[model samples]
Target: MGTEFLNIKDSVDAKNLIQEYFNKYYEPEGEEIPIEDSNGRVVFEDIYAKIDFPPFDRALKDGFAIKSEDSFGASEENPKVLKVIDALEAGSYSKKTVENGLAVEISTGSPLPEGADSVLMFEYSLKNGDEVELYTSVTPTQDVGKKGSDVKEGNLLIKKGTVLSASKIGVLAAQGFTTVKVYKKPNISIISTGNELTELGEELKPSKIYDVNSYMIKNAAESIGASGTIKGIVKDDYNQLKSKILECLEEYDILICSGGTSAGVGDVLKHVLDEIGEVKLHGIAVQPGKPTILGVIGEKLVIGLPGNPVSSLVIFNVFVAPAIRSLLGLKESSLKKVEGKLTKRIHSAIGREQYQLVKYDDGKVEPIFKDSGAIFSLARADGYVNVSKNTELVEEGEIVEVNLFN
Candidate 1:
């Protein structure tokens, strides 16, 4: 056997380890779906606009669209005078055109009359007998939102692989897109294995506890723009777990297993992966989620997350979610993050990079626990503070960027 590196490197190494496996198996599969239900789904192709967003020159503020030169150098002392030829309200297209020395009374978002070059705010003008007087100087293109200014015709509005959100939906609507082609939600099967596990939403019986990691990670999958289903629980029996995982492997683009990823006895996930395909990675240099497994099952991406709820969520959020995006169709912008300050001291074991849950209040982040069962840690956290591998402790008042879960 070739010599092996005993020490796990860092988070980058951990990410790169799984990324290589994801690159091969998570390539986009063909699918078509509707735009309404496509929220959170990845775009399969570039979205082109057939027309501009506004589609016309519209007034931004409640003002009168007038020729810019008409109000040139108008002031309180010497006000410019022009006729108010027509009034336009929001949602109404202007039919009357502004003649020389004329102004068109326009409301917010109302289309500008032809020959109008600028808008005079309502506060800056006074109307008297079919004429308006401007009390303030106005520059060219002052208040007119020009046609095709927001987005032009034939412009690329959204690129392929962008996870659709409310803003994206609005953009699509502006482009007159009724339906769009998107990558179908990659059906994911999550199998939790361990004799110590009980079904979620069930009362615990004897030594078995609730399958906390299953739902925690499954919910994380949905939160970060992916669809996943719990394939239920299985005891630490090799054949039983293998059969169930095989069934899940056939239909799902991604397979996630919890509880049996470690090297301990009855660690069935490693064996099931070894039986069907190669185990690409065994361990990572990360606290709580060190026992992360990345591999391929047929042409699908498979991840065996550590059974701890926090561990499962950490691995799934930082690693698995990105893989789902990269393999399917999405960009890094979909993931949300914000920088924060550490309010308290935090210590970590050497060699393993740690993602510590932190609550931010008053410009400070309070440290959360590394224990796997601290679901409250995730719930209350503003985001996570990264623990560098070289550092053993993070001091208070240290500025650290946090990647928010929400």
Candidate 2:
């Protein structure tokens, strides 16, 4: 008997099912890695500042460090002259304090000497033998970077579940952190199934096409911080497909397969999944991706994507990406959405939600209508617009929301 979809689920219900199932089985663990490798990883715990930034009062400009009161009445016409006791460059300290009539020549980033509360820029002062003339007055703490000003001690620097960026890594470096605790990335095994598919770098046969889904899906997973491993291609054979999946499940946290998921006689993925584990859902109520399959072997997720390259990626962005993000303790749907008016009218299946690929430019959204198998259609699209399942036709000039690709 040919396999058939027993109960098809709408897009919303399907997503909810995948999320709920994964959340129940998977919990991300934390790992300590060097700060150099922490970028793009989620923080496993809150990080706090142990000490004040700057740690001491430092000069912000190259000039003389003096007691502010000494320059209170100084001006260009009648400059105040003070004995230059010592010179302090960046990374150096002055032993002598700035007494009532004394000044210390300090460079930028040098710690301020005791009793010196302000810095006078070199432009406003003239250096002579043993003395410097100050032409401008300075207030207390002027040009002085105070301790704890940038970051106070015990302040929460990075919150748990925050994704680390380049600047965040710099902050950790500033705190003298050699390593950080981050949520471990999920390991995914990607498999492509089709007799007519050939691997890249191999000679193309008469009717075989090079595999696209494995590489595309791998990069897509990596873009979202998951570790994807391409398990190469497997022909449409029941025993071979089942054996490959079983092997992947033994090592990977998730398994993603492309093709052989429809109701056709040769589409044996559903049957293999049924025999090995459980086929949770066989079909989705979405145009171009209705043959998608969701299954599980124990705690490992096995997803069967449509053979069409465009459909495989679209369904991935819709369902698999979010599920992976959830496992990593990240908020799903990070893609930005913008409002735009359609350039022309379009038709969609009445009962199945449609993800109409479009080229969005300057508030004008032009729909790129092509078959699901057309890879160029996805390449030409900047994003996609979701048409509701209840709606059949969208009139021209109608404003719609476009979800921009990352």
lDDT of 2 by residue, 1-406 (tens): 2788859999999999988878877897889999999888999999999889978999999999999999988999999999999999888998897899999999999999999999999999999999999999999999999988899989999999999999999999988999999989999999999999999999998999999999999998998889999999999899999999999999999999999999998788999999999999889999878999999898888999999998998899887788888877788645578999999898998999999889999999999989999988878898888999999999989999998766
Clash pairs detected, candidate 1:
161-330
Question: What TM-score do all the candidates reach, one by one?
Answer: 0.75, 0.97
Off by over 4 Å in 2: none
lDDT of 1 at 369: 66
Worst 10 residues of 2 by lDDT: 327-336
lDDT of 1 by residue, 65-108 (tens): 88888887899889999988788878887778887788888899
Error of 1 at 39 (Å): 4.6
| Alpha-carbon lDDT, every model | 0.79, 0.92
